[model samples]
Target: MAPKEEATNAKNVATQHSQEEQLLHQLPKPNIQNSKYTKRAVLKTLLNRDDGGFALVGERVVVGGWVKSSKETRVPIFRSFLKLFGVGGGGNGGKDSPLSFGQRVQQQPVFSTVTLQVSDGSCVASLQVIVDSTLAPPGRIMPSGTCILVEGVIQQATTSGKHTIELKAEKVLHLGVVEDHEKYPLSKKRLPLHTLRNWAHFRPRTTTVASMARIRHELTHGTHTFFQNNGFLYVQVPIITTTDSDEFSNKFQVTTLLSNKATEEETSTKASGVSLESIKASLKEKINRIEELKRTDSNREALLAAVQDHKKTNELALELEAEEKREKAKANALIKPDRLNFLDDFFSCQAFLTVSGRLHLESYACALGNVYSFGPRFKASTSQSTRHVSEMWTVEAEMAFAELEEAMNCATDLLKHLCKWVMQHCHEDMKFVLKRVDQNIALRLQSVQSTEFEKISYYKAIDVLKQVKDKNFTTNVEWGVPLTEEHESYLADEVYKKPVIIYDHPKEVKPFYVRQNDDGKTVAAFDVIVPKVGAVIRGSQNEERIKMLNIRIEEQGLSKDQYEWYLDLRRYGTAKHAGFSLNFDLVVLMATGISDIRDVIPFQRSFGKINN
Candidate 1:
């Protein structure tokens, strides 16, 4: 063991270590974030590792991806800078170079194929071309949501380690003119989820968004098949309804009266023997009282003095009148249907986008034995972050003759089935998206296929979260608080690192229909959470006894008449039924590791923006 021989061996070891790191980066990192992680950046990061490995930066090479950066000069005149060198200005014969893709095109052409010839002069010539849709034509195209095809040879630059090739445009074919581009406000760029909210139409084109949407679609089908195979009947729940089943005091009112135009008298005038003349008299008296107040205000010395001093009181009044008239005109623009009043005219039958399909699904579950409701649900909650949304898809399943444990088992099996099915179908998209999806698709499918998810009550979950190290949480875990995202994330990501079913939430936190456990303080509720995504699935064993359901309704202080049909489900033939809800958006986020709820759904419909 000579010193010289030992030094040589150490140097060889270091070299080999660097080579291994390069290979690791080149191979896909599964279950990682989907966007903002470019291959080159990942490769560079891996190569620059300081972990005393073989420095293999120069050995490995990246082949291709869409050009994230173009090498265009910042000089006011790019041609002039090139001319300073030995090269001629534009073309070999002094012809002008073609305009870059950023230039706006009047109309995108419509054709079967577009050929882009990336020759020696432009940036496209020195890079791999990604042919995608655009808003306009190829030449001088501003790259607005435009679609195109690319064909070119893969070339490399010897001096720099990075890949540099020319994309020769063989043809530029415009598909069609975007008549209302603003209406379809999507662009060909990577935007933050918050910014993408403004461009709902185009957001789905991004790799993360496209992948999430596809995953969600696959999960939806998986859910339906899982229930169908399990002998559960698929139920179509009613969207427009008079029933306030949960009686949460959040149901949007469905009335025929014009909310703005209908007078208070018209709304409350259900007199036993009152005449129309009496109603008119009461309305006139109220108007007169308002007029009297207005005159009194006008006569006030302070108001009169201020108006006189300002000398714009009359003008201000006139302006106010005009503004009020304009508002009224806008309000009255739409004519009310003969059968419908103003409120109903403005919005058809205050029938809301449902929050969940469980209530209506219960009716079918009672009649059909086992039933599940799967559809888009709307919620008006203002909480906005990585998790919550104003509108989302929910899966609510009801089972007759099923208990809480049975419900929990159903949820676990359904989740495993969904994960398995998605991995089997979405392999290509998974490879295309690369890392950032935070999933080892094969491993997840394999693990879920063989393993049963852990079932723990809410109290157990709280204990698990308490023991989790370095877990940052906003809300303290008490006996009855709803599980916060931090608690859920920690439980799923750190403690379990697998699917964890949390059941028996407090009745105070759960909705009215949730069956009361023997402890009275808790309800038979469950939520299936996994690593990276919080609250992917939620469900409850429903209170089916008419007396108990009515007591729940009374305890929640809801009007019984509003939910008579819901009661009828229990009255006719009630059974011990249990169900669970699957947050399809969360499923997509969990499946793809997409952080934003907006990007998870195609044609996102949520607060601030609703894309048609």
Candidate 2:
């Protein structure tokens, strides 16, 4: 090819590239963070602008955020002059722009300005803000965590940096100065997650926690989308329920009994000033006086008068004693009528924070055909493990006219949908997690979404565990025993390298609600164990036979009277139903590759650990 022809082709390529850039800026963009309700543009909107915020130059906008870092710099006189004229450096335009280059110099000895990196927790990116010291003092807005709302014009960055555009503050609309910079919890550059947990109220400002928040929001949205699209009604179950859904009994009892008892005890203490013993002593003294009168051969009238006084004192003592007994009885009324009775409680019956919503959701599914409940469930477990939190959100779904196979399919589909949703919609946060939390998080999620999970029975799983000649598990495997976390990890992480569904667990280990298998030794229950996080989902086919359910309830030593309402569904119109419950926190843990379940939640409530 000749030189002229080659040059012409290069010129055409350059022209095409220029046109594409122009078209990119002209395309319609999403209204992500800028809205009339917001009254200002968020950092996410400016940072994630379609044209990398370059087209936003010369546009005046208001922004509010906390200062992540602040620096004051001095500029030379010649550079200042060039910036004022908008000739040498990058500026929005000429004098029409809102001080795009720098602020007009006054009587100050040196040309100084403060540049702040501000973030609003909307996204991981922070906007660079240039504020003239005259509008807001450097000392006031210099510290990290100092909040400010400012009106500024977007301008091309004077110096090349991560951000394409910078905000030139024309007016400081609001300034929330940090009083004690040294004492601020977020002032430090880096803090461990455990340390941040202590300052949970302010931890959202951190990049890790902020990213986790976005991940959680997207996961929650994805959950609702999956269920709603699959014709599942979003039914709400009671958080404080009258019966325990599981046999563990690790339930936080919701009652006013303790307070009521305290109040009654206080009233009883205040009611009686004199002791029963003191009254008896007074009666005895009066009787002794009567006896002395009689022994000394005093007048009959005097002796009779003394005897009458003694009788009156004895009657007073008896009245006092009776009042004390009544007070004791009133105090005893606050105690349980029997072992499980809570008659004196606020609800007049035993109530606890629900451990699972499957039972309640089953009732809804029986009527609604398909239903789901998503809310926080509480456990009074004392385990201080990273995975065990006192409060965790669970997503439980029940399907009517469905068996164990359908339930397993539903669980698998839901997990896959969530994984794909997070990968697509929460790309930014997932990237952050990949960088900070786990290196292989994206790959793990993709594998889970695409791979077909392996299913095995309880006996098979036990056999596989026992056959592992090279690996020794902490908990020994047995035929009728529940699989521990160690055993689950080996199956998912070592053997399959993916999720595994273990079904037909031993009846002795499962709850009474599970349908008894034909063998009579195992129940139609399944647990979905994933790598890193074991048993994220637990599901089973419910027992539809009233007699079998009653016997199981009795076998577990649970009161049939308490579960009579649950039995009514089977007695009236029984239908085979199956359901599964997924721990939302555990799902998040798997998605983000965060080892500790506590970190995934906004404010985790764990054993002996509760903070704001």
Candidate 3:
């Protein structure tokens, strides 16, 4: 070798060595999983071949998973010789697909061979399990969605690109019996996303649902970690509340009027002094008196009268017992409707499932400095659109003495954090989603991480919309008019081709709690909009001045008493604060490339549909 060439090669070797040393010090390297290392094995670890390969052939491992699809490819008695060539054992089975190993040996109608696709929940991919019918039978049929535990040896790779390592089943350790194959909701054929929504409970067993579920979970954990690591306290806001800080949205009311009559009956029964224990005691005492009368002092006339008295006591006790039974049945049932006044209901005036934890979170923020509430939120909207759901999860945070720009910065950081976390941890799931669901999800996530979100005031957004008169918009773009989803989508997807953050919205368009800017027309508010979904987050600096809050409440036609506590929060403290709420499921939907909001939530409650 030439002298200069040898020196260059040596330098390259040294650079590679330095990189390896730094990586080792950063974290302990993962052990290569191959044959003979079988205490426990995960799907990702087994399928991963890049990091020095995994799932050694001939390793005996116990794998538990829900069956995605199971097929019994019976090789005809005549084609039995084809097994010698390994035709039907673990090939992809599709002869027509471009990537198939070869033309699949046609299965004969005579002999039985079973192959199962199982997901271990370790990642988005499935583990090919080659089941030998003679060794471990799958009953009459191995239905899709059945859970099974199989102790098997990870042997030879399958011809299919879908699975890297195939497990040769030694025994069918446990096979969950599917009561009726015909009635099972999940079948072998691919079901539409909407159809999957109908079977949320069992949908997770499928690859799409399972992958989306893990992605959502990782996003949630990542979000919590970001805040927790950044010196933020995780505070839980109440689910049932009487306060509606944002008066703009309708609340899902909780009233006792339905069970009012039953409740009243119960109350009257208690007031009338009917206790089961008291009744039982009285019955026993009367019987004892009768027994004493018969045994000790039995004058004929007195004995007769005592017997009559006992009969009368029996009737009265029976009637009381019947009344008690009736009351209990009524009270236990859902409340029946009645003309109940607001003050006479269960919670008294009014109560509801919280629309947002922002208002309550603020109280904690004032005391704790920086705090956040991440929990499910409810809405009573009857709309059946893709964006609207009766119930969803949200993360709302409050920063004391913060402004619109600071809130926007935090939001940008959070979005980037979430994107990076998903890319790093949910790589397989993202790849699966990109292949099966939305093709644009990768770009959406990349835009958040690599590109800067365009920041523009509400006025500036209006100006941009007005300039684009060539394209007719469904929603009017006039100043002071509310910008709908259509408007936001256009600005992000069409105009800027990126995420757009719009702040300083019109005062009338914003809630009463949003701080009014000095201009008196716009409020200190901002919304984060992405390409596909218009606005994912909305936040604002609160109306800190007690007098200003009161005035805004009155001007907005809000009840004075409803916000008394919220007003007290401002009245009692300096209360200059800002907060924003991002829908957790929405984030998952955006990140996973899921088009419908319904598919993202595990159990979605939307419009007139809520399946238990």
Candidate 4:
């Protein structure tokens, strides 16, 4: 072969070699940091409760999770046995070695390992997965929060005096890739809970929010368990009702119905009189529509004159017009209140989303003896405080033949059950929230669980407020007047330093259903005031006396006829019973030490804002 032919063959071989090398570069390139690798690691075995990781040395496993942290660094990789001779390289080329100095240097930053706390929805706590750099190059490191699948060997993470457990990755599969890693929202830096609230849709990815969510689930489960274990029956109450439960807050009107079928009375219309001229005009209109003409009325005046020539038909037309006007007037007269009665409006009388389920619970309690309703309760309160929300969950329980002390015992037991449940089941989450959000969370929970609440009368609370020497009271502490938030907070937070149960409030200050004391000045009522939250719960040994109930109803200025069903409970088979409502969100916030009640609920609906 000629020299030219040989050169051509060499060029073809070189091209093939170049392509192979490019393909080889696509595989995982190892760095000094992540030289050890396991193809896969079993998440369940690794993050299991008893046995942490399942991978014995030199075992292969698959690991799949989201990236938590990623970093790149360079480490010197020594080459050539001749380096033992203490020979050094020059600027570009080595002085005595075969390779150049530039060739010895790694082109990109070296990556060692990536940490991912992965969860497959099986558990609350995520498994910490440390992935070594063998499967990913510097450019290949996925961004924080990027989902990934990997194949690796389970081994001790580092060979040199390192005891940490990690996977030695052989290959990494990008299940979903983030092209740009720098702009990821979450970072190693601590974020404020308020800032996390702004990104509520993605806040659960955060540790604090995730912990709160778990704690919330536990609380819900604990509540259901507590009610179910007790003899109390869970009952469903009407969300939309005609009667207001508590008259203090306004109710949202319910204007829509499920089976919104149109009624014949609404849909029916008067049938047209069979007029020969109208039939002919209708046929012509249909014809005109099909033809799509601009106008065929060149002889409209002549047509009108021809019709007017018949005096009998003209008289009939005038009679029809007068009859139509009379019919229209009759229809309009039938619609007295609304324009045609709003066309099957489904709203004849006023109805609203209920403020409380206690009234319904009372009816159920009268029938079932012991019953409770736990569901979303709505209110139209305009207060813009952190404790106030448009919608809230309430646990309203009623028991027959029970006094206020029994009610208080039930409240204390229920609260203790929740605290114990959190301590046993949600310990991890409780720890996270207590450390990050509020350090006093543990103490608060224990205080509610272990300690007996301070019992004081409403009059006593006022006296205590008057006696305060250190802090000046913002609100007036007068008898027979309603207590403000500032007044209640001082009693619970500063004066008592524990939960204060203030009972026997003024009859006018309390609801109409509260039992009137013998003196007729105070009622058998109680308010559970906590330190952080002013009033978390309220209850009363409801008025069981018919004549006294009537007097109280009159005093509250409520119509007696409207509350006859509630008043009937007093009239027939009256039992000395009491109940209370626990604001579910406030309870969680109080337990977790979160200042804002909004943080405890998933989607908060406030006076002016509704969020997803």
Candidate 5:
């Protein structure tokens, strides 16, 4: 080598050696004595800090849960919700753009990160931090969701009037490792909630679900304290029940029979062809007679009308002929009609799951003088929306000798108490969640506490809705029409822009148990709508007089047999009572500012997704 070249190489080597020595000196010094701050306490302290930006953007935040997902095929988290949370598509002016759909679509919030850690104990030792392959260093399996300590900074994020903040990790310290790692259903690539139904066990590891669950916990605690302090008894209602409280057909039939027994019953019924015979008998009796009546009608004026009537009559006659033929064929086959012996049925008796606890609490109100039932309610309605759930926890309270006015006052006080307690006790949890999921949750709760809810009658709300020119809703919401979600949301989120209580609904739309007002047009029912949660509380004053209750049951054409006990409540000790069923999830959804209901419930039983 040339003299000059050799001299330069030696100089560079010395410089490199000095740099290595400096790096060694800068290595982090571990604290020898481990402090005793529990995970809970540390989390609280992190949240209690008013400078949330420090922990999220500067100070490291090490969140360790479980392996919710891995880097295998999982794309960047941003890719999953880009269209929903992204920028740049705004006013691009495409004629067919989503913005032109008359409603502004919510954009999914974006987050940026540097490191993600996944680990197992033996092969992958503790303290291994994974880096992004494209941008930074090669990724490593430190541990996914496994408990780790990380150092990071917190920063505020804002876009499109919405605000959020998150922790940006500098260095991650992987503590211990967990084995037998299970693949969490929530992956970096977003999947529809229905797809994640089977893996509800791991949904909480997802940021959205975790935030929701925490909010749910906080709301539940708030509700308990709200009633406990308000002199309302916290009554635990039964789960497996026989009474159809809601009187809605959306009840799941409880059956204890094994699959084999069901098969046997099916086979026996098929062999006898009893279902076919029953259909044949009904068809034979009704079709021809109705057809003859239509043919004999004298109101027909036009030849076209006469021909149309003849066509209908012939079709019915043919249907009756077919039914008779079927009956004869069944008799020739020597198969007797099958009888449904309820006693012999392997499934035995079927009972309904409680739809709403309000009625049961009403019963208690009559017996115990004043009572409340707070428990989980089951609904079989298949509505796959942002706010519907099959199984939900509810707080239903009944007050004896209370009128509609008194009921409204109680609901307001209860709500205020709930908001106060959640703000007080759940400050830390709420703070942590706000940092992780929603930034405006505290502000929402603060508003609830600070502002007095506006109260309006149902008729006034309709007048407000009628003024809205957007979408021209065809449901024709007059003073007596049922309140659709759109109208309710507009009242709470748009017009009032706060929690609202809408009362005095038309009796035709309300249930029979509701007390009819002196006007004889509307019932004493009220629905409380929170800003974002929509309809959160539904309640009404009960018809206390036994004679009135019985008349209502008959007027509504409800089977008096199914309501013996409900009637007994009035016959024994009737009082002018009022009650409300507070949808607990909705409370949390509002308190936490969560946009979706699926996030609030752990292992949620949503529509079109049944667990095996």
Candidate 6:
């Protein structure tokens, strides 16, 4: 009764199996190989080769990675011996006859094996590895953050439902055991970004920090490539300089006058009553003695001696007074000092960690036609905002014979190129960032890469802000008032939904180097404001006329002597040039949608925050 029906069912099952086999054959095969740097194979290459790494199922390879998770399993002596000696088994050791070194160790009352999930940080995925407990102690390699390098054969997973490929280790080549798992910061599965900041040295082992590092590398590579391809020479600018590029009085002073020895010496000197007041009192006493000698009809030679002493003492008093005035003048000029004489410092004058490289880049641009400087910059800002950092990397570029418009165009092109470059080259990291950090990061980057940045005058921007009906800006938008970050965010995020360049800012609000417009009230300056992160790029047409430069420098109360070298470029063959600086960290924040600027940098240097 069932012969014909059973035959039909058997035929149907066979057809289904054949179709599944055809689908498997159609899938792409992975081409896996060992790394050139080491004999060990890269986990990324293995995992990304084919789906589940099935293509290299039977290959023997060495791998090195940090342990993500580990579990130990114990089996009965009878089953352990049977599996170890390949007695009536079909698994990895089923074909062995004589007991090997690993097998001999496993022939105990209870044999233990450790299963580990390991990652090398080359990608988000981790590989499964099984190791004999005797080869590598379970207590040593079981905790998270333990690093191990092992030689193993890739096999199909037998227990882990998620991982299709697992490594069966024959030997433990190396072990970087964690001293204590409970005290480790990254032992927990999830930690807040702020918490990770405290452990920056170990944070890179985490997925988020690793992904950020990769993205940062790609962006840096892209930066150099873009500049090199565009005929712009890379110029290394001085990190220490006498001139304040931004004229903002926010530069960190680079001085040796505050050293411990100097401080102790100064403290002792101050405590010894050797100040100007003491000199003045001594001068008065000497003058009074001379007067007494003159009035008492003393000997002519003695009176002459007293008058000579009085003159010498009076001269000392004047010299000390002048020194105090000079010190006060230096402080008023924004060359901040703790009343320490800069003339006695290492440089013999005031010096500072450069806040921007644009001024220096201009000197190179004048000669090289186009030039750029990329390096660390410092600002002595006391701001504790999420956007402010005491130390950061910046990309500043200057173009010769280019005005504000040309500079703006170059900045736009550079931004678009960087966005496109990272999207293409750092696709995996960007995807990880999108998944873990922000969901709309990819879309935001694509929009920036494709859309043309809108250009509007500062007056126009102010008008647009005034007309906005939905949001209340904290800063009161006005004609001469500087645009706050909130104002910039509104323009770029709410009004334009992309980058917006606001140009022709008020002259009072811009730096002295910015060229004044014909209206005499505003300067030919522009800032490229991006969504989420306010202004990322700030550019301006430089003041080239010598007379105007002097006037502007004087108007801003800056020391003209400090910028005379910069002014010489204008005095001697100054062509109309413009330049801008791009905040590299902010660009990262924009691309990754990371809210804090501290997360992007490796070792954050913020207000009251520094670590090795």
The per-prediction CA RMSD against the true structure, in angstroms, equals 15.3, 14.2, 14.3, 15.0, 18.9, 15.9
- TM-scores vs. true structure, each candidate: 0.60, 0.80, 0.75, 0.69, 0.61, 0.80
Per-residue lDDT of candidate 1, residues 466-525 (tens digit): 765675578877777788888887877777777778888889888888888888789888
Query: Ten residues in a row with the worst lDDT in model 3?
Result: 98-107
Worst 10 residues of 2 by lDDT: 98-107
| Models ranked on TM-score | 2, 6, 3, 4, 5, 1
Candidate 6 residue pairs in clash (backbone atoms < 3 Å): none
> In model 5, where do residues sit more than 4 Å from their true spots?
1-141, 145-198, 256-350, 432-436
Spell out the clash pairs found in candidate 2: none
- Residue-level error in angstroms, candidate 6, position 148: 0.7
Q: What's the best-to-worst order under lDDT?
A: 2, 6, 3, 4, 5, 1
Q: Per-prediction count of colliding residue pairs?
A: 48, 0, 7, 12, 21, 0
Query: 2 or 3, which is superior by lDDT?
Result: 2
lDDT of 6 at 227: 92
Tell me the tens digit of each residue's lDDT in model 5 across 1-612.
Answer: 999999999999889768754653564422222125633113323333454322233334454323333333233344435456663356655665545432333343323333332221111111222333332222333335545555444343322222233434455454444453346334335655545556777565554555556556666777777677767776777776767666644876553433334444443435755454455565555555455556775454544554565566556556656665664555434221143333543435446678877777776676676677777888887887688888888888899889888888888877777777777766555775687667888887778778889999998998888888875775777866788877888889888989999999998788888988889888899998888778888899988877777887888888888788888887876678898888887787777666777766676786776564
Which of candidates 1 and 6 is the stronger one according to TM-score? 6
CA shift of 543, model 6, Å: 1.5
Residue 359 in candidate 5, Cα distance off native in Å:
2.1
- lDDT (CA) for every model shown? 0.60, 0.86, 0.80, 0.70, 0.64, 0.86
Q: Total clashes, candidate 5? A: 21
Which candidate would rank higher by TM-score, 2 or 3? 2
Model 4, TM vs. native: 0.69
User: Over the stretch 1-612, how does candidate 4's per-residue lDDT look in tens digits?
Assistant: 999999999999899768755654564432212223744443534544342332243456566766655555443344333355555443345453435552565564443555554553323445444555566554555466667776766554443322334666667666566666655566545677766666677667666666677778888888889988998899999888777667777777665332232222232223444664684465555555434432455455654544444444455557766666665555444222333333445766557898888888988888788888889999888887888789998888999888888888888788778878888887667776777778888888788788789999988988888887887666667898888888888888887788889999998787788888888799888888888887888888888888888887777787787788887877788888899998888878876888887777777787877657
